[model samples]
Target chain A: MTTPTTGLPPEPAGRRSWLRDHSELGVCVMLLVLGALVLTDALTMDVDLTQRGPVGPRTVPVVVGAGLLVVAVLLAVDVVRGGRGRAETGEDVDLSEPADWRTVLLLTGVFLGSAVLIEPLGFPVSGALLFWGAAFALGSRRFDRDPLIAATVSLVAHTVFDNLLGVPLPGGPLMGVL
Target chain B: MNALTSLLDGFGTALTPINLLWAAIGVLLGTAIGVLPGIGPAMAVALLLPVTYGLEPIGAFIMFAGIYYGAMFGGSTTSILLNTPGESAAVVAAMEGNPMAKSGRGAQALAAAAIGHFAGGMVGTVLLVALAPAVAGLAVDIGAPDYFAIMVLAFIAVTSVLGSSRIRGLASLLIGLTIGLVGLDRMTGQQRLTFGSLQLADGIDVVIVAVGLFAIGEALWVAAHLRRGPPEPIPVGLPWLSRGDVRRTWKSWARGPFIGFPFGAIPAGGAEIPTFLSYVTEKRLSRHQEEWGKGAIEGVAGPESAASASAAGTLVTMLTLGLPTTAVAAVMLAAFQQYGIQPGPLLFEREPDLVWGLIASLFVGMVLLLALNLPLAPVWAKLLRIPRPYLYAGILFFASIGAYAVGGEVIDLVILLIIGLIGFGMRRYGLPVLPAIVAVILGPAAEQQLRRALQISDGSVSGLVGTPFSVTVYAVIVLLLAWPLLKKAVTRRRAEH
Candidate 1:
């Protein structure tokens, strides 16, 4: 991605260089947008004449939003001056390897799918499917044993939650037993 | 004498057959979960919080006390048996503990670690019993201005002490404060930032934030970096120490709690600092100088005791001042909120029986951890062999349940998913997750106190620094903010020279 000076004329390049160096400019932009939003929201609140005080609900929001803008500016300058936090390196795994994007994308799908299906399908059915789908996402191929375990886990969770703990879980088709 | 009588009565509550059974189960499960490859005690506590949702507060807290200490005891076992430490504090343990394991002294290392935990937990709990009431008394005298000042202090400490850069930490905190603003304004019943959405009018739930940040976020991050295969597990047996080993560890255990307690009692205290400090203390003071870097039994013993003692010390501020210094404490604060209980000075006056009972149970839970972990060390180590696919999938399943069970809204699941993805990005970018969660829980509280202080002074700006206590606190905050910049400049000058 670096070493890309080939495609452009290089006269007024300091501006581009500053932006490029400040890669965390995106976070700065986000902060400014959020600050604007908070200001917008705080200004739009209905004026309650009956409730007058030294401070009101809007005071803290305004202070925090303005603080964020100042922090964003400082952070951007720091980035341009070559300050950056290092990536996490754990003792357990090989961080040298690029992240397995395939597995990550699949797990994202599984979580999203479960969120959509959970209410309609109920806890037991959605829970089992979530279990099985996540296992697949993480590279499990034991089709026979995985399904059986997922079923047992989901059903047992249903029983323990609904019956034992007294926190009611949705029972779906097996509502009678669960 | 009154405190003693109440504590004894607390024992009567904790010693009941049903509560004892729950304590046993809590410690046992705490160890099992804590032994997972990457999961720490904080993550374990956060994940398992929902299980006690339906129980009465007394029994639920009895179980939580066990889970809290049990998980800490269990963290060291994983460090000794596995290359990766589950908790940051246990990283020091793995230094000496793993070597001891490889050298066929795994049993000895486990014994030292377990016994160290017992000593630390006992002493720490004793101090808690004595100091908590005194601290609560002091806290009662503090007014709204002081309370707001301390909350601001906590906010600064939490953000500045965590993550790589202060700016990122502040950013995460701002995001949390924005989220906190979504609900109806408590005083005037005015909606702040709900954007006409009724679901948001109640504000975001802390449980969803916790589950997303710790459980689902961690699971997804691990999956994204899924290792080619499972880590090779080190086999071990029941923990037992040699005579000489026992003699070696006794002094270290005695010293560890003294070093650990004050650190954990401070706001924004982290478990990692105390453990590392313990390791260095032992290294400097050890008789066996040859074993400094290798498998020094003192290394395992000192850090483990400090780690446990600090865990107990964290509870002091949490229960008395309603300030949480660690990630697990923040989540536990959310748990108290779930029960409609606010832990502060009034907590002692309003619910003495419950408070005493919870403290008494910590002692019981410590004993239970020692009894269960020594014989079951081998059994818990075997849990490390569970396939990654099934393990993480199961985590997601449980995390989803935790979110859905809270108010039973599908929209909560959507919040969890979005927050989980953001958590993933936070992890990837080295933006710590703890600050965000802490800010979310404490943001509303700080604002409430701020307004109360202001109302008392009729909107005078100087009202915030009204009391000498608040003045001192603000001075400390200014010092804290300035120290980092001054240090940076000193280093730069030194480098130039």
Candidate 2:
């Protein structure tokens, strides 16, 4: 999908080529779909006719929905008008690198794990696990050191918040033991 | 004289061992975050907001102030070392400082930036001390319509002037406004966009949105297009700026504050414009044109100074007018509200110590920042060598911790992830983040004022435009909107020759 290089002077396009070539069409379609969904939601919203005065519950949504639709239309128009910058039309940056995926997956896992474990594991252990897991995800191969770092981060954070600051953090299963 | 005595009294309050410790901790944390690429003071403040909930109000504020200025100082470190600017204001510094680093003058660039930051920060603090009370006096006269007008002006300036395209900027801002509307309608207590979910009732925390968009979203975007390349270590040299280099940069450093402060005071626009303006002005004024874009010391000094100065200027407005000119300022305002102290004209009369002590601490912060940045340039540069995977992972970990800690709500974590996804998408599509941030912070306030104005005028549209002050404010907004097109046209006309 790469455009042939013309003899024309290169434009000051930085990262726009990604949008110009591969993503603009998809982005345009997505915008239209999002706009349509929002518009539909906004339309179906029950207008509180009972409220007196100029603005009701539906007023702001209708305005915002219409605005979104208008912007979506404008964006589609810009794509059609060939105003897509060079960054959009250029070759996509490679995403196959392990470092990138590892980071992303690690973060995703950390968030997911934090959600699952926060109640059972408690704030201190869960927070430490989350922290250490994330650090590991960022490619920290220091197996021996990771746990220490994580535990320390979680423990110190707990002490500061729970003990010193007096904010109640969950004690988890260790409620009585700790 | 009375003010000076009161300020002295504030120093007495701020200089306490507890307050001093908090300030130091805040600066240390602020510097660490600021040195990281892509993170800035706004995110730093947001991340720390939950943690600060337990501290006494004065100590919390002292630490917050330290973070604000400390982040500014730290932002310059990244801009000078790597081309990756931690804050929008430091973007200009990166343009020249990166080149300097590449040319093996990394140490000189660091020295110039640190010194420039100190000078600009000092000037901004002095201005804050002198002008805040007067500005607060004027703020007392502002009615709802006036507040509405000012917010409108801020929205227009930020969304229209920021980023490469006005359309995209406005779009980003609209998204933020929409997000801001997710919670209950404050006026009527009616559900706006909760979609029947109880978790969405209180609305998404601004911190969740910020962390998601900035920290998580940024990490995701970076990861998705990771280049498998060996990290380049920036070579370090002598930390001190030579006599000749200092002589050249001194003028730019002096000029930078004036360039930065006015822009900072102007609501909505970020530090980017002023720093860019300062760089251009320095280039035009300089005798050594050949040095520019090729590691010019003035290039490093001017923009760095302007960034810090503008940061100070933003603080003035936040404290006095309760108006946030930038994202960082907006977050700071949120922090103030969290402390149960609403900043405005009444703030001076009500909480003189908090306001003045905060102002006095800026001067103290500049000294601490300089000492840390100047002698420790190499140490800061070592931060860049941190493996990307590890760095980003650390950010995510802390982000979740911060988000969860904010209210201890499990739903906040969900909000963080969703916002992070939005942020990632925006960055992937080249949509600017700051406009959305500024809009989110100002959106509810703007809507509140607009509704109040409408209510006051008995729902007359013209009543919204009735006051002279409102008219003036709208006029300024219109002028700002039209200026870019006018400038572009003028530039094109010149090129036609």
Candidate 3:
């Protein structure tokens, strides 16, 4: 489960075992960075003296940033001392198993693909691709039947939104026809 | 001006032919989505917000009321038949409901759950109508200092009560506040965290955060450990139970509203704690001890009712004070905001017809839910067998559509993807997502009220505790945060003996 999911280079052997165990320190680092960024932005903010009051807009951010720094330090200490969150078992989920990365990557690509093409291809076409790609990612092996169903679903969704619901979803090349 | 008179007038609007039609459509759509795994009412409302954008505020909200109850109604079906409760509130139901289904008593379990929802929803609505106006009347006197005090209490209690740990909960809240701070400052019109991005200056929409967290985030997590093979859905028959089953359920159903209402009425309103408490209560008071683990009808009736009743209790705070204690309420708040409306105490005096109509519709929606869902239980159960991949993929498709349709900008989709990833990471690390959502919706409001109180006091910090109400609220907040830890320490020490 601790497998590097972001397609990063594998960790060096032996020296970083402790870091692997306390991988949540990565969250600590992110929080600290965020806090520092907020603090720097707030401190460097130029306030007009004429407009300034008792509590400027920077006050809450400064307090929040400081609070975040304290929390990040506390969380890091806790993680280094072997504190860890228990896996959620309340649902039917089995969290101990490694993720099916192939499927996840495929689904991610499908969403990003639809996002990139939504303007150029329109709802009917891009939506069909999204639905088909998602179906393929989810292990539907019937290439012949799945895309047809995906198109039907996409067209129906498009008609419902664009025509019936009056949301004016773009139709791309089919803009005039739709 | 009386509550009863206002409610009767509200019925005048809700019972109209067109409004009735909208209510019907809302429930049908709501139940369909709720029957799907991991899609709760909040996600349903956000995804469907665009569909109802053209309707009048009353009609839209009437539909929203229907959808709200319908989600609770459908969530129980998934729990009883699939053993995969879609909402956290229904997790308790899955315990006995799944066992009942395995024993070929699936129909009885579904009936108990549906009927229990009906009973609880009606009782909860009655309580809401009776209690809300009075509370709003009292809340009219609550100044900004008291309001700020209560918001602080809500922040502390919600984070501590719901999450796996207080540390993670606070982190989630701070992150929400940070995300909320991205837009222009409310008082001074200055950018705090936009990072010089023109698109982000308008702020990330609450609907995006909601759908991204509950719908998209859950999708990603489920995608990682994608369950292989088809889930065997329990085949449900006609919805009915034996006389003995009915007899056994009555007492638990009666006890449900009693145990559920007070816990839900409190400031930290949610279905989770009360539903669990009612489950424990029913367990302790059950006649058949052997049936506790196997399949108890009481188990289904009590928790489902508690969940629905808690939902009703949440409305007390949501409607009367404009405080949203749960994620669903927060999105509903956004809905109210979308129509250029706010739901503070003035809402009652200014929009009596709308408020009472919505309340009246809650009663109407409850009856409609039982009548509509009871017969359709078997059909709804078949939806559980939808291919996991396609079903979840369908959810993502709808999520993107909902996000993009909100503003007709591709930038919203980008925000959706970013927030969805953050949501996935939050869940992966065992942080509760609800607080972040609650904080996002409430943080700006909290800040506004805090600044108002201070401005009124001319920078005197002591003005925050100027009133008895504010002082009492702060004291309760301290107790609420400390009592659980104190109890745990005492219990641990005693156990060492």
Candidate 4:
């Protein structure tokens, strides 16, 4: 990705440089779009006018939508005015770094997979898989100990949450046996 | 005498085997979550909210209270050992604690923190028992205008105090206030920002927003910035505090609760501000100037105590006013509402047993926390050894499961992902997330009160300032807003000299 320079000078100490860039501009545009979407829905909302004394249903939305517009403008103004707040203190992580990308993708995969598999595999088995997979993603290659630890954690959590705390997590295929 | 006797009765209810067990569970969970990096007590309580659904109301309250203080203790442990604070309140602890660890005095720092925590927790609990009813009595007399004024003050205070920059904080808060307006209007049944999504018609769950922002967002942020370096091995030594160390810390422990409790009782009052204030105070008052940043024992003692004390203090307002001073308190308040037991002025008159039993259990929970944290500091430290990948993966899995378990709605999972992305972006952009979370929780309540005040006065703006109490509250808000500018001016003049 090309770094689109907005010609704004870099931030001073203790401030983030990204805020000086065009990122927030994109966010503001998104907010405006969201506001339009919300306002459209709010206009079509069925409001009862008979029971209320003063304030009605559309009052808060209209107010909120208008407020969002005002803030979006202010944020735009701040960006243009080069209003720098605090400088970023820590070393910036390289977004393009392959190692970093691997970790990100691995974690995302684990989350997505767990969401899909949790009901079928049960929390105990799926949770263990999730935990072990994540550990592997984060560079823990202790293959011998990882599975045992993951299973232990999953079983303990299942026992506490399902048995003691009474959360009705699916016991999966092992429901009757367990 | 009557008050004393009533407290004894309260204690009687609290010490019951069932209540005691719940309290123990709450503290244990609180401390465990607190110890974990990136998870605070708020997320802990929110995550556990589903589990508490079937619990007896009293047991639920007991467990919630335990988790509250337990997180405070656990947070300090991470600050001391890893320099990764679980919450903002522990940031000050990290200053001295990390230094202490580097110097091989980690045990002493941990010991001091535990003791300070115990002292602060006890003092705050005592205040809660003695002062809550009186506060509740006073609160009953307050009208919408006064409530509105107080919330305004809270909004300003929290935004200005919690973040590195006020503009970003306010922006975050505004975003929250906007989110708060999404559900059906209390006065008019009209949906404000639902956008034809039926699941959103009921409004976004505070739990979903909270869990998404704090838990899921944090997990993502950590994954992106995952450190590849080997863990710093903490040196082992005697875990006992020296007599001199104890003597030095005692004064700070005693003073910390006084500083922390009042802040905790106020709206927007959470552990962050008081703990920061406590750390600055200890630094300013210390005779050992060289020890200020070089593993000063006082640094660990004061902030830890203040954080724990504030936890206790927050419970007082939560129980009495039906106002949540922090995210964890809000979840607990929601839990109480689930049980159909409103925690406000009438609570004492209506459910004295539940109120007092909960209060007494705080004392017991504090003792248990101290016992567990003091000797088992190393055990808690070992939790940090879990690989970042596995840890975050587990968190993400649990967060999704917790979201699904809440309503069994796929929509909630979608909201979680959206909010998680938003949270990740917020962190990436350097915006503070706490104020946003706080605003989301309080925004609806604040707006409703404002609208009601306006209605009462026939849409007159002056209606908000009608009563003497309301006037006083607004006056305080004005002063609070102005005080920052005044302080800045005074400091500039001094610098010029």
RMSD of each: 3.4, 4.5, 3.4, 4.4
> Which numbered prediction scores highest in DockQ against the true structure?
1
Candidate 4 lDDT by residue in tens digits, A56-105: 56666666666566666776666556543331111112233322557767
Worst 10 residues of 1 chain B by lDDT: B425-434
True contacts kept of each: 0.65, 0.27, 0.40, 0.31
Candidate 3: residue B302 Cα off by (Å): 1.7
The chain B TM-scores of all candidates, as shown, are 0.97, 0.93, 0.96, 0.92
Using lDDT as the measure, the top candidate is: 1
For model 3, the superposed segments whose C-alpha errors exceed 4 Å read: A1-17, A50-52, A87-92, B267-269, B492-497
lDDT, candidate 3, A100-141, per-residue tens:
778767877888889889999898888889888988887888
Candidate 2 docks with a DockQ of: 0.29
Question: On residues B1-497, what C-alpha lDDT tens digit does candidate 3 reach at each position?
Answer: 88898999999989999888888887887787788766788878877777655568898888887888788778878888878776677788889999999999988998898888888888888899889988999889999899899888888877887765777778778888777777888888888788888888888887788778877777777777766654577898978978999899998887787667766766554787888899999999999879987999999999888888888888888888888877778888888877878898889999988898888888888888888888888789887777776777788888888888888888888788778877877777766787788888888888888888888888899989999999999999888788888999999999999
| Better-scoring candidate (DockQ), 2 or 3 | 3
After superposition, the stretches of candidate 2 with alpha carbons farther than 4 Å from their true spots are A1-22, A25-52, A84-106, A174-176, B1-5, B95-105, B227-230, B235-238, B488-497
Tell me the tens digit of each residue's lDDT in model 1 across B340-384. 999999898888888988899899999989988888888888888
TM-scores of the candidates are 0.94, 0.89, 0.94, 0.88
Ranking by DockQ: 1, 3, 4, 2
The deviation in Å at residue A168 for candidate 4 is 2.5
How accurately is candidate 3 docked according to DockQ? 0.42
